[model samples]
Target: GNEYPEDLAALPPQIIIGAQYVQAAGVALGFKKKGAKNVAYTYTGDGGTSQGDFYEGINFAGAYQAPAIFVVQNNGYAISVPRAVQTAAPTLAQKGLAAGIPGIQVDGMDALAVYLVMSEARKYSVEGNGPVLIETLTYRFGPHTLSGDDPHRYRTADEEAEWEKKDPLVRLRTYLDEKGLWSEEQEEAYIEEVNEQINEAMKKTEQAPKQKVSEYLQNVFVETPPTLEEQIAKFAAKEEA
Candidate 1:
């Protein structure tokens, strides 16, 4: 899912932390060179701002005046570490100042606000303005991952309850309902449609063939290295056995 093979414009995000920022700048520069109006955008957590690549990427984009957007989802935590512990910057958006790019912060919980901000940012960038840094004030409801994190360990239930009140889905649905645009029946039907689609996708996934260890090893190299050749042989032998 990290790699969207079907979408050519959707580059696979780098696994190395903060690497996508620089990649996006490069993509934006490529578009500019081709005289295209397209802009490149990438996202990272508040914690990712600490990485050296973040500064380098933004700085490069700034100096070259490449059309790019860097979004920081300041969910208040980077895994187990709180945002306060990450940096002393008054606001993450201000980090763009050092790179000579425009920076702004918006209410991450309000979907409409985010949409408006992104619209303006896209317009600014595509119109020859360099990169923009946007910090979205948000919160995480559950563990960073379902694996080892426990929100209760670091954040208070009171804080969680406060954020739950600002849930974007809830706010958006309320606004739609107020405008007489959404109804319970429509919501129910949409939910059923989504459930069916998810079920079908899961069924297809369950029926997919399993990949072998040998296949993974072989795919890693075009001309297999001697070390990998030995590994492939050992795994293939074990698998055949």
Candidate 2:
């Protein structure tokens, strides 16, 4: 489900914030149109919220009172770009206010807190209240992507060390441990089970057949237009050669 768009302008207005934003807004809009008595929710990162489409999408939803919940996962950096560089606003949630929507900033590291805020927001939307924005303050533990710039260049070792101490996973595990629901043995067992599952899946994937050369031409059109047909023919001819 993780994919990227080659063109930004070609996408639907609501999706202009990229795939994640688009998906979230779509879900919300669907709920609204379906006459659902509940709110629809979607989440995106701080970096994504910086996009122009993000504001437009939220504005439209707010203006129409579309029962939607927009959540911003503000993890300090949008890839290598810092939050300060992304926008001038003091908080991402405040941006929602400009569109006549209520926004709340919450500690994203606290799972219970986030859940509670989301639950209340959903309740409000279900009651015919307009859209609400929730900005979650958190940090990413890994590099922006599997292959990308190192975070150490922008953040000092001390800063990262401090964030590590406040890691959500660690905090949640600590809470669970306190409740006697988790222990070292439990952690090890979970990790082992997950690893085994991952390995099995990987093996299955590797054994799957490689796609045929013609497969690339299959999904481009439902009823192939003349131009596409020509292109497909050319591709097929080249393959034959």
lDDT by residue for model 1 (56-82), tens: 999999999998999999999998898
Best by TM-score: 1
Worst 10 residues of 2 by lDDT: 1-10
Model 1 / residue 59 / CA error / Å: 0.9
> Residue pairs in steric clash, candidate 2?
none
Native-structure RMSD, model 2: 6.7
lDDT, candidate 1, at 102: 91
Candidate 2: list runs displaced more than 4 Å: 1-19, 188-241
Report the error of model 1 at residue 43, Å: 0.6
Angstrom error at residue 187, model 2: 3.6
TM-score of each: 0.78, 0.71
Which 10 consecutive residues of model 1 have the lowest summed lDDT? 1-10
